[model samples]
Target: MSSLPLTRVDFDAAATRISGKVRRTPTLEAVACKSDPAPGARLLLKLENLQPTGSFKVRGATNTVMSLSDEEKARGLITASGGNHGLGVAFGASMSGCPAVIYLPESTPSSKAAKLQEWGAEVIVHGAVWDDANEAALARAEAEGLTYIHPFADPRVVAGQGTIALEMLEDNPEIDTLVVAIGGGGLIAGVATAAKLRNPDIRIIGVEPIGAPTHHAARAAGHLVTLEKIETAAGTLAPRTSAELNFGLISAHVDELVLVSDPEMKTAAEWLWTEAGVAAELSGAAALAAIRSGGAAVEAGSCVGVIVCGAGTDGIG
Candidate 1:
């Protein structure tokens, strides 16, 4: 364990390092950005769902994979993902012109596997959970001399994820609060780090699936705690463990954590589609779920930014 190298400078470097490589992502101001319209609370959406890979995962994956040396890239890349991050790694490997091998748990849906494969990755199904698959992916990386990109554990990846906050604050200097969904914690970790560094008073509220509650449990215990089982259908946001790096960042920078149920997320997703025609996955809608449910305090006319982290047809279809 190396000490986490996350800082404002690192985040700025990642922003500049992956500028045109990844979309800057647009910010949309709309009342519909909320789960339900609030009388005076304004909602702005950071539309990362519009990214090339349809998720914010690409930022970290691109920063990690592209930062690799030519020889490292030539050695190939390997990782484990349930969905979004796998697509991100595949996209990163493709950009690097390096072969990518993504390991998925047997429980992952065929549609997700197909999506990764579509990105030119060699998809391998192994074990019964993401941790099991991750172990296998690690072993393969060691045995085959492939570079392994940890979804949330790596500092570079975390720093890359923070770039979203940099862009958001730049676009809306008055954004007083940031609402983000956490899976493995990379996105929230990065965003919180950047946002807090930029403005220490900027509130960072992290949303997690009620069933998962990875960070909530960790914060309650004052250390990392792995869940015995996951009970959420939002695979992208159901990681049982939040890596030490992410835990530390969230602890230091995040103002609060909100838990949203799968049903709430689905309702929020449906609301997004109906109100703004934005197709958001359940995980992506978790932030709005917290917002409109009064999960956090929304003072009148406060400018809050919610990240639509990914795109999916889960709610509409």
Candidate 2:
């Protein structure tokens, strides 16, 4: 809600405000960063999967909800999420003593909807896809005069998510590349902006499920594009479309876009759990999957940062 373009300065400030409010999170250094084209590459995992909400969405939702004025907070909040975002918003709103209404597609798993409801959010099941649910949520927000908490399109949300890059780079100054999962491009765009601001030389790579390649399609067309249908097991990353503003941010800051199959992501998630003891969701493991599939190569002795973005068990193993 601040402006069209989110700045690194604002991101840092949000990080400071949410410092004690959120986990500083831990970083896992991969023993073997590369074995092929990027032999000897050093890699570290930013374990956002360990956040209080079991996902990085809390960072954005917390920041946005806390920034709301008392009047706005009293008005209640409404939003649409694939899964993780809804939980984050619900938790944040509850913390702020603000009621929340979450609109989710009927396709969303009952387990996820139950989690949101547990946080005191009134869950509404409507539509068949993320976009359709989003439209309905928007309508409810206007009709009820509730505050609309956008999942990713808002500058506040982007800045909040960008704080992850700041925290990671602050601890590992040698990082040369960042690989992140992309949904509506919120996490990737924010991370790219913050990481690039700190080190313009750092390469920002985005990974999306091959079944839901919104960012990939948008990048190809140089604009936001919507998918008629998405059929990925990675529910959190199955946004039917990419936000134009987020697409622009990613296009300018991200260096490359790669995709991984659902099966590949599932394998990556299982591998991470076994090898790193990290509980990663399907979409959360996608960045690592892309790298494993030879999507991007890190230079020898260079440090690369990978975001383990979520831990929800909705659509992933």
Candidate 3:
């Protein structure tokens, strides 16, 4: 990590490396509705939900898993996720016939655990938040010599996530402002790093749930900080603390962070479903929530990109 600078994240290499291993998910323009919040703003949706695991985390997990040595794969893969990354790691390991153990928080939806199980990964419902599950996962990895993949901290994972930036920018170079949701900060970290490096003039806006403003608080304190408890229904976005790697990249590359409420996300999700038929999870609709709720002060008439990052029936339900 010390050797790698923010400018040299190598998103292109990650794109080519993970080429056929993952889908080059398509992007589409969000046609305006009569009730549009930001009228005249050109909104483009990078539908990462179309990915095999129904989240962008697969890009990072597949890149990391494919980079592992055969001997390391034999030792098995271990990681903790609120939900999405677990599915990613499980799917990635399955391609190699490697065993994987996924540690998920109690907050994770049962549907996610069932999906992970479908990939042949052992699912352990651990503590209440991502940090608690992560602690247990790290302990088990250390105890059994398993290869642990850090969701946000690893350079490989960050680089993989950066590939989304490459694809989106290439697909539409006019995109001036990119709005992304923040969880442990991996997605935004990678997106900001790649987008800023690729086009220094591009603005990056990060969104988080108001209930779990981990990176927002970290940015406020100008250093890492942990929360007392989690409260957001966007479980994937409720990590109490942000990783140092993600914090550094986000602090360096992201322009500003906005916060949205759970209700706002639900509303945005409902809007997406009604308007575009995008059945996104609460965390996945966070970027749209920020824009729709005017939390992100995006300039009107400017082209903007938002990633609908995960899939679920929650909003529709």
Candidate 4:
């Protein structure tokens, strides 16, 4: 798993390596709701929000951190994230017996920061935004000879995320469309790669907040384009730009990208909690919001899958 596009074979290897260690989160058919789809039109939820670190990021972080060589492992690991990614690194490093250092934006929720510290990672409060925190983490990793475990932008992480789609497809072969939330685009990249490999016809739709539409902007420019400013309640999806690797994968595999409002995500989060007893943060619920807003309409009988990706929330009990 070098620095190349993640494929199904890499996903298979990752799935084998991390099998029992990670949860095979369940997929549930959507029940009729007052604000969701009309009766007789079904939806499916892949409940990755229920994962141990309360997010799908654990799958990628665990895979990437565990893939480190013994020498790399001995050197320790460093990462930067807004919240959920930091938790994943902290949790994964603990399992692999590696010392972890996490850098987070000043705006990171205290609930998420506390969770990372509780998982035994050294938490550094740095910069006002993610990019600034990332720069600090990179400098520290280089100065301290630590292995940098990126939240995204690495092949191993992408492969690990792709495995989620493989699991979901295995559970529900009839699935024709997948709605996924995009931040740095690792989750969607991996998932789109795997979904296309298994079923090229499956529609891969990426949901982004209107305020932070990295993919949409990049696609329009026909290259990875950085946004001037970030503004979103979906903090996990606030990356200023998609990486070149993620852009390539998304350009090649993802079928569509849609934008949703913060209010729409809030409604979806509340609905999921009330209807399914699932606790989802704004980023995790954005995918379902896309579908409900008719951004991802499907045939009547077709199964459409949405990833409830993460839940590192102050609201989670």
Candidate 5:
């Protein structure tokens, strides 16, 4: 499928494709804790952190890798990522029995690199940031004639990520809003499309780190724009620019955009650990941060769904 406008049907088909290949991560009512909700507010957390790779990136990576032709698979898989996506590729390749090479920024956490190696990936540490590593991966893919899996820009990846929405709506049809963290916008794009298709009135709120507000910047400019620099601890959410297709999807389906500070995310992560016993990374905690920090306002008693998308960090404490 092209990066055309996705519908609920696409998400449904993706759910079918990824069934059993990925975990059907759970959704639970937010536990009462330090990050307690506003009076009458109800919070539902989608725990994608439980995925085998400790992140939602596996859903898309597995779908993309499994969809490859036998010949393409033989050529091997190659991709670039900050941390979680690389781990997703490594895990997906292991499942598919394909040789894989993962390019990562030098700044990537040691724990993530160790995980990639544990999954048997040829880990190449290059560049100082994700964009730099991404450029290297692209050139290497062309030079080596390898199949490249984009972290978030490809349609297949987006469709795979959309499966989360299908499961969410299935488990809780009454959800009135979905709060999701945005990086390259793949997850939010796919989710917004599916959630809106399921219920046209369902609000899709996209959250980004204030330091890496690619989606917010793009929205403000009315087009895709690159940031001069990024400085967020949420490495997974630090893309220089949003993809064009993702921008289109966001413009068409996402209802609002909010930005949260790095410290807010840390507090949210700590709250998840202390209150809910969930080990969330900074990126994973962004949606909840948006809510707790009042960056994304919700009416009291509204059924709010927040995606805790990853847990690949060393520790939340």
Candidate 6:
């Protein structure tokens, strides 16, 4: 495998490369609420849920799809996703006029599948978890001679995801800490790389569901290790293992890895709806959940930013 090519310069270039293709999502000061981390801490929410596909996955998917050669685009795109990434791939392929086949785990919510189809993707329901679906997608890609887009493993995908950090910091240069949700680790891998390169003093904190702490377990073991099983309300974050490239990036750039419970994420989702009028899915609310539950820390008066990475579901009420 090639060494990951993620860098501050790569991220900056990706920002320019994918400009106007992906949403330059806004960053808003978090509304004061009962779930506030610290009384005087300034919390900014990077509203990635506002992306074209309702998730930050569009950044990486669009960048990767757009970078493909004419021949590769003609060969078509294939991948597996828990939800958000599939939506992104579907959208990207549609924009690029390429056929996309997305393998989704059996547990994927129907709404996500419907959205993927709405974007003209050929959706295949396979396996019980993301890893299983991913294996099926890879096999199909090989059999069909299609280009496989690994959700969080490829360098282009990571660089594309890094664009979120670029926009966040550009919008708020004083952001001293960034809290992001981790699934296969693409978003944080990219965001941490760019954010740390931009300001080494800035802290990059990663949040994962306690039931699906793929990156957390990998960090503890000091190597990638697949979970025997995963169970979480944050289905998008239930990948059994973090990609090796993503693990290495997390080790190098991420400052902290915190686990939040499904309940905590659910409460955070509710809080976002009631307090901020933002309807965040559980995965999208994971970062805020970490802060609210004290799994991730914020110092008073510090400028903290959270990536609200997706809003694929209706209000969990």
My TM-score estimates for the predictions, one after another, are 0.95, 0.94, 0.97, 0.95, 0.97, 0.97
Off by over 4 Å in 2: 1-4, 32-39, 313-317
- Evaluate all candidate structures by whole-model CA lDDT and list the values in order: 0.87, 0.84, 0.90, 0.86, 0.88, 0.88
User: Which pairs clash in model 2?
Assistant: none
Q: What lDDT tens digits, residue by residue, belong to model 4 across residues 211-296?
A: 99999999988998888888887778898876888888889999899999988788778778878888899898899888777776
Give per-residue lDDT, candidate 5, residue 52. 91
Best by lDDT: 3
Task: List, in order, the clash count of every candidate structure.
Answer: 1, 0, 0, 0, 1, 0
Indicate the worst ten consecutive residues by lDDT in candidate 4.
Answer: 32-41
Candidate 3: which pairs clash? none
TM-score of 2: 0.94
What would the per-residue lDDT of candidate 2 be over residues 67-184, giving only the tens digit for each residue? 8999999999999988778888988888888899999987777887998888889999888778889999999898989999888998788888999999898999988899999988
* lDDT (Cα, tens digit) per residue for candidate 1, span 15-70: 88898998999998775434455458878999999998889999999999878999
**Residue 67 local lDDT, model 2:** 87
> What are the per-residue Cα lDDT tens digits for candidate 3 across 1-317?
22335554467778887999899988978885656856879999999999999999999999889889999999999999998999989988999899999999999999999999988999999998999999999999999999999888887888889889999999999999999999998898888888887899999999999999999999999999999988889999999998778988888889999999999999989888888888899988999999999999878789999999998878665
List the pairs of residues colliding in candidate 6: none
Model 2 global lDDT (CA atoms, 0 to 1):
0.84
RMSD, one per candidate, in order: 2.2, 2.6, 1.6, 2.3, 1.8, 1.9
Ranking by lDDT: 3, 6, 5, 1, 4, 2
Give lDDT for model 5: 0.88
List the candidate 6 regions with Cα displacement exceeding 4 Å.
1-4, 33-35
Name the TM-score of candidate 3: 0.97
Poorest stretch of ten by lDDT in candidate 2? 30-39
What's the lDDT for residue 31 in model 6?
66
The TM-score measured for candidate 4 stands at: 0.95
Residue 160's lDDT in candidate 1: 90
Candidate 5 per-residue lDDT, tens place, 197-279, comes to 78889999999999999999999989899999998878889989878789998899898999999999998888888878889
Tens-digit lDDT string for candidate 6 (1-317): 12456766787777887898888888878766465554679989999999878899999988888888999989999999998999888888998899999999998889899988888899999999999999999999999999999999988899999998888888899999999999999999999988888888899899999999898889899999999989787889899987778988889889899999988898888888888888889999999999999999888889999999998544367
